[model samples]
Target: MSNLSGKTAIAGIGATEFSKDSGRSELQLAAESILAALTDAGLTPADVDGLVTYTMEKNPEVEVARALGMGDIKYFGRVNFGGGAPGAVVLQAAMAVATGVADVVVCYRAFNERSGRRFGAGVQDRGTEPSAENAGYAWYTPHGLVTPAQWAAMAGRRYMHDSGATTEALGAVAVAARRHAATNPKAWFYERPITLEDHAESRWIAEPLRLLDCCQESDGAQALVIVSAERARDLPQKPAIIKAAAQGISGSTAMMTAYYGDDIGHLTEMTLVADQLWADAQLTPADIPTAIIYDHFTPYVLMQLESFGFCGRGEAKDFVRDGNVELGGRLPINTHGGQLGEAYIHGMNGVAEGVRQIRGTAVNQVADVQNTVVTGGAGVPTSGLILGADR
Candidate 1:
C-alpha cells in the first residue's frame, strides 16, 4: 500500500451554487467555499497549515490564505493542465497531511469560466509570451487545431472508426449524465433532462460531436478539507478516506492533441494513472461501487471507463448500453449529474460529488458504497483518486 493511503481523509466539502453567472468575483467564490469547508470540518482558519489549488486558478495561494486568516502556511502548491488538476489538488493536500507537513490542508478551485473567459473558444496564442506551454501549443495551432472541441474531435473520430461505436453510443453518456443532473437540485440542468433522441438532434459543434455531448461552461468554486484520519473522526460530517491518488502523463502527450501516438483512440495516460490508483489502494474495478468519471466531453467518458479497466477495450459501448452507468447499475456514474448537466467547475465539483458518495449523502446515493473512483479531466495529462468510506 502507498504510504499516503488511509493516512489522510477528506473531512469536508463545500461549493458555491452552480450557475452560469456566479455574480461574484472568482476570489470571493474561492474564499466563500474555503470558509464553508472549514466550517464543515469543524476547524477555524487558524487551523489550516497548507493550501493546494490549480495553477489555472486566478486566486493566489497567499491571497486565499490571507483571506481566510490562516496562520503561517507550512505547505502550498499548485497543479496544472486545466481541469486535470482537481483530484491532483486533493492528492497534494493528502500528502501534506500524511507526511505531517500540515495538520489541515485545503484544496480549492474557482473560476468564472463562462462569464469571464471561455476556454472552449480557440485562442490565437496562449503561450506566445515565451512560456514553455506556449511552445507546446505552437505545434498544433498552426495547423488550425486550436479549439478544445476541434482538438478532441480528431481522436473521437478515430475511436468511432476503430471501435464501430456510433453517435448513439456517445449519446448514452450524455443521456445518463443529464438524467442524473435532472434529479439533482443543485445541478444547473435540474429538471431539464435530455434523451438519446435529444442528443442525436442536437447540432454538431464538431462532426460526430453534438451540443449535448459537450459539458457546460460554468462559473463557480469548490473546496475540500484534508486532515489526518484521526482528526477527521471528530468532524461534523463523515470522512471520505483517501484510499489512493495518482496522476499520469503518457509519453508523446500533447495539450489536447496527441494524434501521432501509436493508437489515436487509446487513453494511455489515464490507463497509466488507473494502474497506480488500483495498486496503491489494493482495489480493482469490481471494488468500485460507483464512479465519478470526468465528462468534460462525452466521448472521453467512454474512453475513461475502458482505460480504468471497467470493461474490455472497445466494450464501453456495450457496458454502458447494458445500463451499467445508470442509477442502481453496477457502476453508476456521475450521479450528481456531471459537467454535462451540472455546472462545469473544471471537474472540482465532480470531486465534491465523489466525497458525497463516500459519505453516503449523495442525492442519488448508491447503497453500501464503500469505495468510489473519481477522475479528473480526460484527453489531457490527467489525475484520479480512489475514495473509500471512513470505517
Candidate 2:
C-alpha cells in the first residue's frame, strides 16, 4: 500500500540464552544481543546508525550506542505499552531505513524480569508523588486487581462465558506451544512436554487463568537487524521481508484493561491491526501458513485468531481443539514455542520466531512458509507484522 511495505527486510535475529536469571545487568544483556545480531547479519557495530526499542526497556539507546562504539546514530526512538511495542519496534526500524533516515537499524528488547522487578508481583510502591500516570494505574491497583494476570483475567472470564469455551480449550495453546518447545533447544522448556491433564492440574493464578496459562517470567534479550530489501539480498542470510507492520489502539483501549468496550470477549485492538496489515500487505489469513501470537495469556491468543479472521468470533476454541496449531496442522503456529513454552521476552522472541519461519531455519520450521504473521501484546494498544520471504 505504501513504500514501507516490502521496502525493508529483517536481515538478522539474535537472542541470549533465555533463563529465569541472567545474573547480569540489563545493559549487558542488551549489548550482547545487539552484537550477536550484527554478527549474524555479517556486519560490524559500525554498520549501525539507528536504534529502536521499547519504552519499558531499561537499557537506554545512548548507553547501547556508546557501548558498541557506534558513530552518529541518525535515529533513536522507543515504543510504548510494554509488550505491545515489540512489533512496533520493527515498524520504526523499517520506516527509518526505508525513508533514508538511516542505512542500518537494529531493534532490540532486554530485561531481567525474573531476577529483578517482576511485573507479575504487582506494583511495589506508591510514592507520595501524585502524578497523572501513576494515578491512571491507581484506578486499578486497588480492589486486588493489580498485576497483569488479574487485569487480563477479567476479559478472559467474560470470553469463556460468552463463547462457551472451556478451560481445556485455553490449555490447548499451552500444550501446542510446549509440544513445539520440546524440540527447540533454545526454549527454556526444551525437552519438556506437558499434557492437557497437566494443564488442568496446575494451580490457578486467577480464577480462569492457570499457572500454565500464564507466560514465564524470564531474563533474556532479543534483537533484529533491518535494512533495505536491496541491501538485505547481498547480506549473509535470507531476508525476512517486511510485508507489513502496523500499530493500533481501539477507541476504548487501555493497558491490560478494555472492559468498557462493547466486546469484552474480543480483542478490538488486534482487529484494527489486522485490517491495516491486510491492506498494507494486500494479503489475508488465507495466504499465511504460520502465525506467532503473543502468549502473555492463552485466552488472548484465541481472541487474536478471531480478530485476525483466521476463524470466526468465538470459534478459536474449535480452531485449536485438534492439533490444529501443531506441526502438521493447517496452520502450524508458535513453532519456536510461544511465551508459554519458550521464555517470555516480552514478545520479541515471537518476532524472532516469525523471522526464522520465513527463512526456513526455525527448529520446528514449517514447510513452504510464504507468509507468517507475528503479533505483539494483546489486551492493550498493540501491533502486528506480516513477514514474507524475499520474493
Listed in order, each prediction's TM-score against the native is: 0.97, 0.98
Candidate 1 worst ten-residue window by lDDT: 122-131
Give one digit per residue, the lDDT tens place, for model 1 in 1-391: 4678888899988899988888999999999999988988888889989999988889998889888788989999999888787778888999988889998999998988889888888776565777787887887788887888888888899988888888988998998898899999999999999888899999989887889888999898999999999899888889899999989899756668878898878998899889989999999998888899999888889899999999989988888885679897888899999999888988888888999998889999999889999998888888999999886
Q: Give candidate 2's TM-score.
A: 0.98
- Which one wins on lDDT? 2
lDDT tens per residue, model 2, 108-161: 999999999888897646554788767777777766788889998999999999
Would you list the C-alpha lDDT of every candidate in the order shown? 0.88, 0.91
TM-score of 1: 0.97
